[model samples]
Target: MTSNLTDNTLDLDQAITSIKIWDQIRDAAQKSLRSEPVLEKMAHHIVLSSKDMAQGLGRLLSHQQPDTLVSREELEELFSFVAERAPQIITFAAADLEAVCERDPAATDFFVPFLYFKGFHAIQMHRFAYWLWQNGRQDMALFLQNRSSVLYGVDIHPAAKLGKRIVFDHATGIVIGETAVVEDDVSLFHGVTLGGTGKERKDRHPKVRQGAMVGAGSILLGNIEIGHHARVAAGSVVLKDVRAHATAAGSPAKEVRG
Candidate 1:
C-alpha cells in the first residue's frame, strides 16, 4: 500500500511537470499582482481569475476582436468551441509560450507572454485561424487573420501550416503567404515576408524547415526551402534555396557560412 501510494504521487508530479506552463503562468500572475496591486483588475480579467490556460487564452484572444464585428461574448464562445474541438490548439499555444519564455530575453515568465505579448497573441490567433482553415471555414479563418493584422500588425494566411515551439519575435509587418510552411522550433523577426515572386496560384511560397532562424526584414520568395538550421541575415532578399546549417546574406542572399 505504501509503495503504491508513493508511485502514484510520483506519477502525478511528472504529469504536472509536463504541463508546468499553466502552473508557471498562475504563479507568475500571482507574483505580478503582488508586485503591482494596481493592476489587479486588469490581471484578474485575463490571468489571475481564469480557471486554466484555455479560458485565459479565450479571454485574451476574444478581447482582440473588434467591437464593430463580433461581440466579446461571441468571440469568446467561438474561441472556446475551437479549443474544445481541437484541443491540440491549446497544446501548441503552451509550446509557443514556452518558446517565447525560453528565447525572448524580455519574456522572463509565461505570464508576460500570456497577457501582453502581441507576437504570442498573434501566433495563438494564427493557430485558431489554421484550425478554421483546416475545417473548411476559410471565411472565419480570414476574419481571424484580419483581426490579428489590425491588432498585432502580423499577417499570416490561414492556409499556412505552422509547427510547434515557433517564435515570432517582434512580429510586426511579418507576412506569410497561403502555402508557406513554418516547421517546429523556428524563429521569425519583424518585417519578414515569405511571399511569392509572381502571381503563381500554386505552391510558390517558402518552406522554412525546423530550427531555422529568419532575421528581421528578410524576404524569402518562391517555392524554395530554407534548409534545416539555416539562418537568413536581416534585410536580405533570398531568391534561392538556403542549404542546411548555412548562413545567407546580401541583397540577393548568397551562402556566406556553412
Candidate 2:
C-alpha cells in the first residue's frame, strides 16, 4: 500500500508538470463523470472529446448562441480562426481560470467554472470577439457581442481592453463600453458599469487599473481612472479619478479612510 501510494503521488506530479491546463480540466471532468453520473454525457461532449482548450471553449460558447442568429458550425469556425490567429488568448484564458479558482470561494475544481460559470464564459467570448474586432471584422464582432449579451447578460464592447486574471463575479448586468480599459488582477462584481456619462465619442470610458476592485452596482463613468489597488464601494457612482490604493464610496464617489 505504501509503494502504491508513493507511485500514485509521483504519477500525479508528473501529470501536472507535463500537461497543460486543458488536460487538467479534462482530467477533472473525467473524474467528475464518475462522481456525477448525470453529467457524463455533457462532460464527454464538452471537455473529453475536445482537442484542446480553444476547441473546447469554442464549442461551449458557441453552443449557447441562438440557432437563428448564428449556427454552432459557423461560430465554431470563427472561434477556430481566432484560436489559430491569436494563440495568446489561450494563455489569458488559463490565467482567468486560475483567477476564478483563487478568488471565488464557491469554485471547487477547474471543471466547475469551465462548465457552469457565466462570468468565465462571457470573458472568453469577449476575448474571441475582441480578436475579431482587431482583425477588422467589426460587424462580426458586434454580432458576437449581441449574442453574448443575450445569452449571458454581460455586455462588453469588443474594443474594450481587458487584462488577464480579471474576476467578474456574478457577471450579469455588467457593461463595459468601447473605450474602457481594465488592467490585470481587477475584480468587478454584478451590475458594475465602466461606461460614459455623456454622449462624447472619443475615449469616453473609465480606466480601471491593476489590482482594483469595483464593487457590485458601482458605476465608473466617463474618462476617469480607478487607480491601482483601489476599492470602490458597492452602489457608488464615481465621476472623477481615484488615487492608488484608496477606497472610494458614495454618489460622485469620494475617497474615504482606508
Candidate 3:
C-alpha cells in the first residue's frame, strides 16, 4: 500500500508537469498567431479588430492587467464565424490579398491602401457603440456613429448588421445603410454607396448577395437585389435587381454580361 501510494503521487506530478509543458507550447503558438505581423499581414484587419475590441472590453471591464489571453478554441470560433457569414472580408484580408496581388495588379493597388486605413479604427469603437445600443444607449450609439463617420469616412449606422469577411477595400466614402443586409464574401470597392433611394422608412437600401463584388464608384440604391457572383461594374448606378452571374454597367445600369 505504501509503494502504490508513492507511485500514484509520482504519476500525478508527472501529469501536472506534462500539462504545464503543453500549456506553454499553446501559449507560444497563440501569441505568435495573434501578433500584428501574423494577424494583420493578410489584411486581416477584421480579426485584428475583433481582438482589439475584446481587449478594449477587457480593459473596460477591468478584467486583468494586460488582459487574459483568449482560449485557442475561442479564437478558432471567431475565425470560423468570419469564414461562414462574411468570408470575403477575412479571405481578402488574409489569403486573397496575396492571391490577388499575384493575379490582378489593380486589386493590389486598391487593397494596399486600406491596410493602414483609419476606417477600421472604429471597429472597436463600434463594438462599444453596439454594446451601448443593446443596453438602451441609443443616444450614445448615435453619438459614436457620428464620430465614426467624421473619423473614418465609412458610415455604418450603429444599428446595422455586419457579418464577417466583409472587406471595404479603400474604405473611403463607403456607406452601409440602416437596413442593408450584406452577406458573407461580399467585397465593396471605394466610394460605393449601399443606401436608400428615397425617404422610405422601412427596409430600404440594398441587399448584397454572397460572393458578389460591387465595383468602385457604384451606387446600389433602394431594395435592390445584387445576386451572387454578380459584378456591378464601376460607375454604375443600379436601381433594379441584378441577376446572378451577370455584370451590371452604365448609368441606370443594364446587365451587359454574365
Estimate the lDDT of model 1. Answer: 0.85
Per-residue lDDT value at 174 in model 1: 95
- For residues 1-258, could you state the per-residue lDDT of candidate 3 as single tens digits? 001110112234433443443333334334546664554333232223333322222222221112236443443344343233322222223222333334344543422322333433444344445445555768856865776677677787766655434556666788888787776566777788999978678999798887788999999999888998799998899999999989999999999998
Residues 104-188 of candidate 1 have per-residue lDDT tens digits of 9999888888888888899889888888888889998999999999999999999887887889998999999999989888999
Taking all chains together, the TM-score of candidate 2 against the true structure is: 0.91
Q: Give candidate 3's whole-model lDDT.
A: 0.56
Using TM-score as the measure, the top candidate is 1
Evaluate all candidate structures by whole-model CA lDDT and list the values in order: 0.85, 0.85, 0.56
Off by over 4 Å in 2: 1-19
Per-residue lDDT tens digits for candidate 2, residues 123-171, read 8899888878887999999998988898999999999888878889999
Clashes of 2: 0
Steric clash pairs (candidate 2): none
